[model samples]
Target: MEKLKMHTPDLAEENYKKLAALFPNAVTETIDDDGNVIRAIDKDVLMQEINTKVVDDGQERYQFTWPDKRKAVILANQPIAKTLRFEKEKSVGKDGTPGGIDSQNIYIEGDNLDALKLLQETYLGKVKMIYIDPPYNTGNDFIYEDDFSQSVADYTNNSGQTDEVGNRLVQNSDNNGRFHTDWLNMIYPRIRLAKDLLSNYGMIFISINEIEVTNLVKACDEIFGNDCHVATFVWKNKYGPGAFTRGVASLHEYVVCYAKHYPNSIEAELSEEEQKKYCKRDNKFEKRVAI
Candidate 1:
């Protein structure tokens, strides 16, 4: 009897097929994790194709490419050895009823990547909204580890000092050679994972700043598709530092929203005060009225 293949669809595999269709020479045979022969892409050929200018128009069109991009995609798809454990004692509830401020909500404390992976079995395609305030890649903000294969002690000493609870996060400044690459690798996998969690009608919102807004949008365009991009809202960031931008004070942060599947119509929910004003018309005009 043959064994079962029960897992999420390999996006990279599908991408390989598509690439093969366009440029058959780019397809190659490779050994996978299980030592079985599998389809893979010839990266050199693919790069050649990417750099190729169109014959019809003498113009070049290429995507935002960076170091560790391929690794980031692989990381999102790779299975984690970690599992989530429930703390029954620490859980918020009445004795056994699973009660709290809201019974349906669960608060998992762990690395965000680990948490996203663990939730896949239960919450895949079930989530309606995903809002993430990722590290902004500012001078003082946290940047993720480049090589997890390195020793923890070496990483701790080199990257950053231990915080109160002892979680280490390196400060990512523009001065570092891998400043953008480090931050990109950190958030890329998480964004791909987030896209998987969204329902067909769901949406994902990302909070970003001047430092990394363009990169974040480019990543999302690849992950969620350009057609799914909704909007970007400029919000006044409350009392943030102005040292980064030099003389001109920085006041706003961007909230970028993208839909899994675009809806035909969107309706905004009204507050109590707003709802109260939607009564009868007064003199051919809708006027505010207290309920």
Candidate 2:
């Protein structure tokens, strides 16, 4: 008797092999998130196989892009071998002491991208809300430098440039030519992973300053869909005006909100003072209002 094949088929890997057989020229090698060399398909070369027009580097198109944006997307989809380790000594129990594996609260200290990937198994499409205050990329911020273009051999040889844990702690200074590009690459993959964790009714609130607000919004729109954007609230965080500068001295930051799926309507409760003025029969509902 023949033995059973108990494993499920890897559709993605099967499709990749099929495509490579069809277009051998498009088959290429690239480095994954973990610095492992992997086979990749050159999208431009694959597209040209079925296109009539010239699909080369000079083609005009509408896109929100920076250097290595494709690499960022690739890194988001790549799987990592790293796993989360349970630390009993660091955990707090319901009584608020250490050595509490039964604690509801868990703190993960490591690269966030790796943590996000690990959480996908448990939290994918289950989280209702997520709030993150990422680095503002104010030229002084130390952004994660992900080099997916390098192989593991090259990375290990240059491990001295990274931190003890192999984190490339590169500062995104204004002097750096690829300052914005580096920041985008760092945040792009993280957000891509975050989107997978959201439920259908899930919402994400991201706090960002004016420096990269526009770019961040564009990136989120691409990831979460343009129709899912709920609001962008301006928060005046400072009391007095900032110091003199060449441009305007802005006193506010922005909180951008996006939902996993667009809602039919949104409602909010009226304040006590406003409720008194409107009376019970103001317009629609009794106490709450829609905005």
Candidate 3:
């Protein structure tokens, strides 16, 4: 067998050279992900060299990216043969009519990948709405496990689902250089599968933190198509000032919404029970309820 060697020159070196050519001070030796001192460019310093205070328009050249982004796309497209095994013990009713599933409300707790694959046969293009609250990729907080080299069958067959101590979740730490890459790999494929489960009039809402928001939106755009992007909602969930932050007071997180078609409209009607709680009446048709 042939051995792999350092075939391609370090991309960082070329990047530093370009930055150094423009701003010499910005180029300096820095410890990389591997802890080896290497020539690298200071992004903030390099940006300072640019003359524009304004960013370019999206149609021209803006993009969201990370290392091995194409791999994420490939992972999304790969078909998984895994199936969701039934959990008889955890069902609401032993007869398997849990939550009146005959009417389409049911719960199955298992590996999301396997569950999603199983869902394809029954729920493909049949779901009306989807809301996902994935693990927020904060270093040491939590992580999604994705072994890029392993096939779906390998995942189902392997016993490495849990760590040494039996923890199912993985940790994406700050020092683990593939932080963003690992996250992108995990989320992209799941979102892609979930998108397929949506009907023509369906929509998806994803709650995410700032760290992966940009990358997530780009991945969603690629999977759901750019025209499907509906809105990015900023939710001020805090009642008061939040925990200590670097510069700005923290009070908001985000929900990114996407639709199966372009220019979709959201319609909401208040129920009679909810409408009865209205305490005030206004002159502007005093009857419109707040969604």
Candidate 4:
């Protein structure tokens, strides 16, 4: 019998191997910061292998980008040194006993990015669905500024930015410069990591306010691919328009949904009653519903 692996797959290394296999001519050597020789893919050679004409940065193309976008991509592929341990004292058993390990539920308490990274080891391409109500950057919501290079101790002990557990939180005020840029940087890597965890049939629903809905959609389009977008459902939280801000009264938020793979899967199955109603067959098919 073979021993099971205990850690998540190194995504960067895996990607490099795949590229090297496809284009052996692109394989090259490079020196790291530690002066160690390492295998690296030559970008120029790789581009030549895939395309007849190189689309350089100067070329005009449709894209959604912000400052540090490359850094966000790097962050998603970077490996972490963190590990998760079961805390009996903090966990509740299935039978409502303390320190019992009978429960199948797991509640992780840590930085969201780190927690997501740890979950990749066991949950990659396994999760059926994911729903998240992340902080909407409305000038008051707390957003994590992920930076693994710095230690918790290195962060300033400002109560406003540093939470009790040393997670760096930034208040994305509308008045600040790079208001949208900051939020994009924060969410881009999270969605990238989340894509790995979702199975082919999995769907992710994100609850976001109007403040950042557009950017969120564009970000998801890049991560999950534009075709994978399922739908954006408007949720009316209030019966009527309550307080007026500026000149408008916000009455609802939005639930943006995306599928891991579209055309092959639907968000849900129709009810039995609804399914039976679609018995009307079209000339081209056996089962068809009215458009």
- Better TM-score candidate (2, 3): 2
lDDT tens digits, residues 150-254, model 2? 764576576535555666566678888997888899999899888889999888999999989998999999999889999999999877655664576678999
Model 1 lDDT per residue over 1-291, tens place: 876335544556655667788989888889999999987777777778888633333455667768988888898877666767677655665444533333556877767776787777778899999999988888778755646676879888776665454555677777989888989999999998888889999999999999999999998999888888888889997685655767778889999999998776657767989779874467865644431
Q: Give me the displacement of residue 23 in model 3, in angstroms.
A: 50
TM-scores, one per candidate: 0.72, 0.72, 0.63, 0.83
Q: Pick by lDDT: which candidate is best?
A: 4
Which residue runs of candidate 3 sit more than 4 Å off their true CA positions?
1-63, 94-104, 148-168, 242-247, 276-291
Q: How accurate is candidate 4 locally (lDDT)?
A: 0.84
Q: 142-166 in candidate 3: lDDT tens per residue? A: 5556665666556545634554433
Off by over 4 Å in 2: 1-59, 148-166, 242-247, 268-288
Arranged by lDDT with the best first, the candidates are 4, 2, 1, 3
Q: Looking at model 4, which ten-residue stretch has the lowest summed lDDT? A: 151-160
- lDDT of each structure? 0.79, 0.81, 0.71, 0.84
State which candidate, 2 or 4, has the greater TM-score.
4
When summed lDDT is taken over every stretch of 10 residues in candidate 1, the lowest stretch is 94-103
Model 2 TM-score?
Answer: 0.72
Candidate 4 residue 177 C-alpha distance from true site, Å = 0.6
> Candidate 3: global Cα-lDDT?
0.71
